[model samples]
Target: MDTLIFVLFLYVLLTIPVFVLLMLFAVLTRSARLRRAAEVVSLSACAALLVLTFERAFEKPLLWIVVVLLVAVLAFGVSTIVKAARERP
Candidate 1:
C-alpha cells in the first residue's frame, strides 16, 4: 500500500514538470539528452499506470490520478505536434 501511494505521489508531482519540460524542449534546441529523458519518464509512467490499472489495488480516489495522467499525456502529444508545425517551412 505504501509503495502504491509512493508511486502515485511520484506520478502526480513529476508529471507536471515532465509536461512542461517536454513542451520547453519542443521550443528550444533539439537536444537528444532532454528528448531521451522525456521519453524515459513518460514511458515509465505509462508502464506503471498500465500495471496499476490491471492490478486492481488502486481505490476510487486514484481515478483522479488517472485523469491527471491522461492530461499529461495529452500535453505531451499536443506540444509535440505544435512544435512540429512551428518548425515546418
Candidate 2:
C-alpha cells in the first residue's frame, strides 16, 4: 500500500507538467470545449488523488504535498471556468 501511494505521488508530480502543457494547447487552439474538458479532467484526477491519499495512512510531508497540488489544480480549474464564462458567446 505504501509503495502504491509512493508511486501515485510520483505520478502526480510528473503529470503536473503534462497538465500545464495540455492547458496551453487548449489556449493556443482557442477551443472552449477543449479547455473545459481539460479543466474537468485535471480537477477530477487531482481530487481522486487527494481522496486516495487521505484514505490511507501516510506521512505528513506526503499529505502536505498532495494538498498543495490539489490547491494548485483547484485554482487552475476555477480560473479556466471563469475565463470560459467571461468570453463572448
Which candidate has the highest TM-score of all? 2
| Candidate whose lDDT is highest | 2
- Reference-based lDDT, each prediction: 0.66, 0.72
TM-score of each: 0.47, 0.51
lDDT of 2 by residue, 1-89 (tens): 77877777776776677678778989899876777777776776676587666665255555777677777877787787888688857
lDDT of 2 at 45: 64
lDDT of 1 by residue, 1-89 (tens): 86985787578568668867885795597775576567667655665665555355346666766657665775786577568658868
Q: Determine which window of 10 residues in candidate 2 has minimal summed lDDT.
A: 53-62
